[model samples]
Target: MVVGSMISQIELVLNELPESEKKVAEYILANAKEVMHMTIHDLATKAEASSAAVVRFCRSLGIDGFPALKIRLSAEVENTPHVGYFDVESNETVHSIIDKMLSNTILTFQNTASQLDAQSIEQAVSLLQQAEVIYVYGIGASFIIAEDAAQKWLRLGKNVYAISDRHLLAAAMATKSENAVFWGISYSGETREVIQLIKRAKEQGIKTISLTRPGNNKLSQLADVSLFTSRAPEAQLRSAATSSRFAQLFVLDIVFSAYASAQHDFTVEQLAKTRKMIEILYD
Candidate 1:
């Protein structure tokens, strides 16, 4: 499925919707083809939800109205394949594992893209552009994302720090640049250490950005700008940072690509310089 597909958007935000709106989402997801041909009243009736609930559901997925929702759904149903995440079964074949992982990764990218807001991405890029120093922090699997982001910006000659130790990060915060940005990454959006660091950054008047899964969470609420990943469905295989990490990386890659594009000449020069330096060191 393509990025920002209507079906993917609905699925990504499904858990956050109210019960009334959820009924509409559930019905539409199950009967996507039928919903495309149905009117708002028809859908509401079939879903056992009110017409107002149908409208609210549409809005929740970032659609303006029922008609627009149906139009987008119609296009999505025609062009997008019906791909769903499959949990591993006992005694599964290697082929099955390969296919399932690929499907999960594709779903993660599409769903995360669906939840992303263009304006928020633009705002984040602007913050990264202006900041003299950027402090990236996360715990557990998210810390990997933090280091990945720091390495990307560092290649562009940006001052970036991704310290794994919370105590060490706290110490560095005291000596932050005057124009600094703090980015916290946590899939659940409630990691204690990340939250504490974000609070400390706020207290220091440093701009803050947060990346988390879809829905309201403390970290997102506390940040000046918030980025989100798709809420990956839990599975035994997924518990090991498979789909969730893919989603997080997808969002950050988009941000980094956008930032690099905004300064194409400089980015190319920096990349070439870094590559040459590495080659020379290898020699």
Candidate 2:
């Protein structure tokens, strides 16, 4: 956990915990304010779980230990409670829909930003910059993020390819340059195609980057550099993509902006050239 709301992180990993660990998570979720004052032993006894289970739960959240978890909970408990995703109702008003969606997006961005690791982001940028060719892959909604990422780097004159077809991407990976990079976007961190391609990329000795939601995941575990977005709970009509996608895009903007900032003059020149080219198309 970088610096955002700790409670949200707990919720994000709640479902992933084991039966005994889930008990600890449930207790904390219900009594976050009180948990701030209770000792680890107290919490373990109250949650009906052991001290080891408590420690395991904390580790699952990327927290070092029970004391750290309490400190984080105390800090966030005083703030306004975390506003989770709300499903759009059949009878929802237009105004209500707008408000709910806006709130969700804002929270998603805040949480995602808080959890970001500056060093990890820096490493990812360096890899992208050193890469001679970049291949980005995602499936369905994630494909949109992959394409957007390709365009951002393309404007900087990078040879970036965002191929939606898994077969084609695999073919490209086979002949990828030694200095190539692969970026994978899967919110769940478990998309089969993305995983398969990342494995291929690694086999070819290409540096790999993964964009996924916060928490332990297969994709992040496999990537050389891991970036995370906020977890968006399921929504009936929206399927959580509305906020999750925005969160993914938000992370992308941060990475792209950081990359651009590192090469200020080059980025400015390239952006100017691309802008002029777009203007020419309009003319």
Candidate 3:
């Protein structure tokens, strides 16, 4: 089976594990590709559990042993392309910036595309298309992307709610149902408030989506559909966030445009009406 199939299977079996084994199960589910590259000791260390626990965790998944599990995981990783990371220097020239930015953007697209599951994107778009209410939450730089998503969906005639206030957003999530979609955008995927809101949405049975950097993080683990941006490591000046943010928003635009194209006539009419309204206002 393919890596995506393995991941789907793991997700299906995740809730069946005992509470003690669940932690390791969660870690494996979130970090399946990365786990293949890690040693048994390294995997145990990262999961903050012992080797015995890790073995038991694998057994719970119906794998014969760690080596067999690792072999299957390695196959999954081999099928996926690797992402590259570059560091930017402080005194970089304009030409250097252009070159680095282009490289970073290309790498970001490649990485994101490699990890993109067509079914998940389709599922997310379906949820967004049918959602009666959509709430987006993010903090700092991610907040900007959340706002972008809100704007795009709003223009497409969807009811979008994006607020910077954590408490207010959490309250909004409480009143929503499966017809509502809560999107959580975070780069590190460990942002406390975003994670908290997504958790609340999950408890409320609201559809949840996450956009974050490619890695194992709490936000992705809890999300119904997880979309990853490129993994750009931060420097002293924090150029990573700056470049990756644009890349992520670009992906969002692609998703929005694709969705609009899928409903071409309706979206076209909507766009024309919006333009006419704006033109009348300007006149």
Model 3: per-residue Cα lDDT over 29-73, one tens digit each: 788878877887887888887888888876654456788777866
Give the whole-model CA lDDT for all candidates, comma-separated: 0.87, 0.88, 0.75
Which of candidates 2 and 3 reaches a greater lDDT?
A: 2
> Model 1, stretches more than 4 Å misplaced?
1-17, 59-64
Compared with the true structure, the alpha-carbon lDDT of candidate 2 equals: 0.88
Model 3 misplaced stretches (Cα beyond 4 Å): 1-85, 176-178
| TM-score per model over all chains | 0.89, 0.94, 0.68
User: Going through the candidates in order, what is the number of backbone clashes in each?
Assistant: 0, 0, 0
Q: C-alpha displacement of 77 in model 2, angstroms?
A: 1.5
lDDT of 1: 0.87
TM-score of 1: 0.89
Task: State the displacement of the C-alpha of residue 185, model 3, in Å, after optimal TM-score superposition.
Answer: 0.6
| Candidate 1 lDDT trough over 10 residues, lowest sum | 1-10
